[model samples]
Target: MRAVIATEPGGPEVLTVAELPDPEAGPGEVVLDVAAAGLNRADLLQRMGFYPPPPGASDVMGMECSGTVAAVGPDVEGWSVGDRACALLAGGGYATKVAVPAGQLMPIPDGVDLVTAAALPEVACTVWSNVFMVAGLQPGEAFLVHGGAGGIGTMAIQLASELGAKVFTTGGTAEKLAACAALGADVTINYRDEDFVEVIREVTDGRGVDVILDNMGAKYLGRNVDTLATEGRLVIIGMQGGTRAELDINALLRKRGAIIATTLRSRPTAEKSAICASVVEHVWPLVAEGLVQPIVHGTMPLAEARAAHALMESGDHMGKILLTT
Candidate 1:
């Protein structure tokens, strides 16, 4: 099997395709002949030595993939060889073969092809868990998501809008904002030119948003707090804007808002499995019905993962960049 391995902690140039041993399924797991892998900011961070895989996990730099089952291990049920599925992986997705826990596998949605399904698991689980399960975004409530044209943001906007939430998103350019609007975002703010907090206030008659899916951590912390409606929930999943910041305890207390920081990679397998199940149950139907769709910017060969990383780093893509076998 050929896998993308980082030679050292540095730039994307350090990533190289090399032959590696094929993975075998362990108990309650399945071995997938990977068709494609999704590129994410976390992968770039890992390549740069900022993020490491959890203990006892693969060192490869991918978090999600779609493929056919090549083999199944003992105790696994309802899946077999040749089943078309996508999985939320802890690591090892940038390879021809990967062993995945059965619980982390989802049958490809009815209308999605195998290659495109690679882009779904990560964004689906991330948005469904944070926005719906954790933040408890309700129909008719206002929702805000930063980085509205990226993978998670695109999915979040569609899912929230389809479920009846008034969706607002921030992007850096007109093209990106336009893409977000076409995906069902009701309000699009150019973060570089506008104050999103003020926009949210004006759009909602100063009520603020009930739920926010934030990727910028410290930099947006204060503003996110200011933009939240009373009893609002803000879930932070990434730290593109740095990690440390001062929080206004008084403002939070006055609004009765909650700030939660979470990461999907370090979670226990059981929790990941539960999230995958929930996504399949609640989100897959929307996808199957064409109410939501995978937003892939482009696909590259697995050996060209370095270029894919470069593209992500350049911020030139509207959605996911996929690496195909």
Candidate 2:
């Protein structure tokens, strides 16, 4: 098997391809012949030594992949060799072969290709778990998302709209916001030009949004609270802008709002599998119907993982960057 390994913590240049032994499925697990892998911010972080793989998990950097089942472990049911699937992984997706718990594997939705299926597991699971499961975005209510053109943002906009939420999002450019709007955002704020808090307030007649999906943690913390309706939920999934911040507890109490911060990769296997199961049952049909398609920015060969990382760092992509085997 061929796998991308980071020899040391540095730039993407440190990533290299090497021959590795094929991984075998353990109890309740399945070995996948990885067809494609999707890039995430965490992949870059792990490559540079900021985030490490979970304890007792694969050392590889990828967190999600789409492929065919090459083998199934003892006691694993509901899946078998040759099943087309995508899976959310604890780690080890950046390879020709990787093993994942069977519960984490989702059958590829009808009409979706193997490579495109790679793009869905992470974004679908992330958006479903955070925006719907945790934050409880409701139909006809205002929903705001930061990083509106990234993979998670693109998926969030579509899924939120499909579920009937009036979506709002912040991007760095007019083109980016336009792309987000095309995906179903009712209000698009250019964070570089407009104050999103003010824009969101003005758009909603000063009442504020009912739910906000944020990736800029510390930087947007104060304003996020300012742009929330009573009982509004703020779900923070990433800290791209910085981590530490000052918050006004009184303001939050006044709004009767709640803030939640979570990461999918760090979750326990059982919880992740549960999220995967629900997404397969509920969201996969949307893909099958073409109502919620994964937006792929580009596909690059797996050996050029550094170039993929460079493209993500440039912030020029409108959706996902995929690495194919």
Candidate 3:
């Protein structure tokens, strides 16, 4: 098998494709002949030595993939050899063959092809768990997501809007904002030129938004609180801005808001399995019905993963970047 590994923590140039031993399925797991892998910001962070995979996981850089089942281990049922599936992985997706827990596997959605299915698992589970399960976003409420044109943001906007929430999002350019609007975002703010907090407040008649899905962490912490409606929920899933910030306890208390910071990669396998199940039950139907879709920017060969990483870091792509084996 060939896998991409970082020689050392640094730039995209550090990554190289090399021969590695093929993986075999363990109990309750399945071995996949990977068709394609999705590129994520976390992959870049791992390459730079800022993020490491959880203990006992693979060091190869990838979080999600779609492939065919080449083998299944003992205790696994309802899946078999030759099945086409996509999975959310803890690591090791940038390879020709990888082993995954059977519970993390999902059949490709009705309308999506096998290769494009690679783009769904990570973004779907992330948005569904944080926005609906944790934040409890309800119909008719106002929802806001930062980085509206990226993978998670694009999925969040469509899902929230389809479920009856009035969606708001922030992007850095007109083209990005336009893409968000076409995906059902009711309000789009250019973060480069406008204050999102004020824009959100004005759009909602000063009541603010009921839920906010944020990726900027410390950079937007204070402003996110200011933009939340009373009893609002704010979920932070990324730290592109920084990790530390001061909180205005009084402001949060006055609004009765809740702040939660979370990451998907470190979660226990059982929890991830449960989230995958929930996504299949609640979100897959929307995708099958054409109400939501995977937004992929482009696809590259697995050996070109370094170029994919460079593109993601450039922030020029509008959606997910994929690497095909």
RMSD of 3: 0.5
Number of clashing residue pairs, candidate 3: 0
Model 2 agreement with the true structure over 238-281: per-residue lDDT tens digits: 88889999999999999999999999998988999999999998
lDDT of 3: 0.95
- Give each model a TM-score: 0.99, 0.99, 0.99
RMSD (CA, Å), candidate 2 to true, equals 0.7
Give the residue spans of candidate 2 off by over 4 A.
Answer: none
**Backbone clashes in model 2, listed as residue pairs:** none
lDDT of 1 by residue, 217-294 (tens): 999999999999999999999999999999999999999999999999899999999999999999999999999999
Error of 2 at 77 (Å): 0.3
Cα displacement (Å) at residue 212, model 1: 0.6
